[model samples]
Target chain A: MHEDRQQFIQGVRDCLPTLLGYIGIGAAFGIVGASSNVSLLEIALLSLLVYAGSAQFIICALFVVHTPIPVIVATTFIVNLRHFLMGLAIAPAFSQYSMKQNVLLGTLLTDETFGVAASKLTKQTKLNASWMHGLNITAYLCWLLSSLAGAMLGQWIEEPTVFGLDFALPAMFVALLIIQLQQQAAGKLMHLLAVVGYTIIFMVVFSFVVPSHLAVLLSTMSAATIGVLTKR
Target chain B: MTISTTMLLIIIGCCLVTLIPRIAPFILLKKVSLPKWMTDWLSYIPICILTALIVQGMWTAEQGKLIISWHYMLALIPTVIAALWTRSLAVTVIVGVVAMALVRMFS
Candidate 1:
């Protein structure tokens, strides 16, 4: 039990970097939701429930455009479809845990948490529910609280874009992806580059015809398939 | 804006859609054994998804016309460098945002 507590604390420590980025993005989100006349409670609930940065932004944008409900729902579904893969990727680590535990843990999984958890898994080679709990819950709390703060403080910041806060998500992703890539074998860099090209091409081509989120799903699946085929 | 019945419905719909995709896979696949090849494929999902998302964020279609934001592209360079050098998410984001703010200020 003591060891579990230690691991859990470590998980939260690992999430410190994410906390900084989340506050910036979450605050930006709060500002948008506030200006859109979205109630503070609703904004907080959206952060609490939806818990996705890009998807929440899309939801706000769609609402601003007055897009139809069904379309908005469908778009959110497609955009979030990738979370299935994220859950799947970490499934093996939690295989020993109960289904209920997995379900609970899965709820806290996000792109940043997935990256952090996956990286830890690659190194630790053991599944500690406490560690995963600490990592995920810390990130989740940061997102929820920071967004709430953003919503409440919405009027204070007029233009997040002028300050370049919009780049937070992409910057985080780029860093995370690079870290993952750096961990791979040098010989596999070429294969990784090819996989990137394959993924981007599929995304660009499919995005023209399909809804943007669906295009992401299709392209990611194709890229993964290509990775599987090329692996020795 | 105040929440209306229609907005509530939309929010619920969004919640259901997000919840199902995120929570279902682990529950459904918990006991089932996945193929080895499938596991291999799963490894690439992160890269593909992140790249696709970043690209989508950097460019978008407006009125059926594709428009690229050169500012984001410019910011990406410094961000990439900082990420590679520091491998710190906080530093990379700070540098990227600063780079972008500078670009927007000048141009």
Candidate 2:
């Protein structure tokens, strides 16, 4: 029991740096939400529930655009569909754990957390619920706190534009993409194909799409199809 | 909609969306094994999906007007550099934010 407690604490410690990043990004999301007429409570609640960086950004953008609720919901669903697959990919690692453990871990499984957790699993043979709980709790707390701070500060700062904060989301995404591309094990051709396919499809479809959701759906479907065909 | 009500609805909606994908695989695939072909395809999904999202986020325009401002171009430099060097999320965000602020100040 003591060993479990120690491992749990260690897991949280390992997750600290990533959690800090989540907090900063989450705070930015909160600021955007508040500026766009979303209440502080709403921002906080969404941060707690969604806990997804990109999805939250997209939803916040939709709010700024005054998009319909159904569109917003559907877009978020499509955008976050990868998380489902990610959950499945990692599920086998936790097969020996209880259902409650599975659900709890699932809630905390963001892209960063999954990458870290999956890598750790590869090096270590044992899978413990405590480590997952600790890592997730640390991330969750950071996200909540940063979002709250953003909400509070957002109320005072009328225009985030004055501080040039509006571009943070895109910048962050760009940085993440660069890193992802750098780590590709499938070779340069795969990377080029993915990039070229995505750009062409996104531009072509986005030009004529009525519901913006179609843009993401069509791009993903077409890209995945191309990836499968060319991978062989 | 009232502020609180909108917040509630958004939260509920996000929760529902997040839960569906996270839980769907476990319930449906508990007894079934994913075929080799499907797994191979799944391996590449992240790269493709994320590339599309990043491109859209970086270049998408509002109201048919392009925004290729100096600030955005300036931010890209540090973002790419930091991502290449550290692969640290915190560093990436900090560098990007700092670059934007500096660009806005100087240009």
Candidate 2: which pairs clash? Answer: none
Query: What tens-digit string does per-residue lDDT give for candidate 2 at A1-232?
Result: 9988997998898787565457666777777778877877677778778878778878888877777788788888877777786666566567676676777778778766665565454345346778877887888888888888887888776655545555555555555555556554556656555555665566456635433434554665566666677754
Candidate 2 is graded, for docking, as acceptable
Q: Which stretches of model 1 miss by more than 4 angstroms?
A: A124-126, B62-65
Residue A222, candidate 2: how far off, in angstroms? 3.4
**Angstrom error at residue A117, model 2:** 4.4
DockQ numbers for every candidate? 0.67, 0.46
**DockQ score, prediction 1:** 0.67
Inter-residue clash pairs, candidate 1: A37-B1, A38-B1
Model 2: residue B94 alpha-carbon error in angstroms: 1.6
Residue A231, candidate 1: Cα error in Å is 2.1
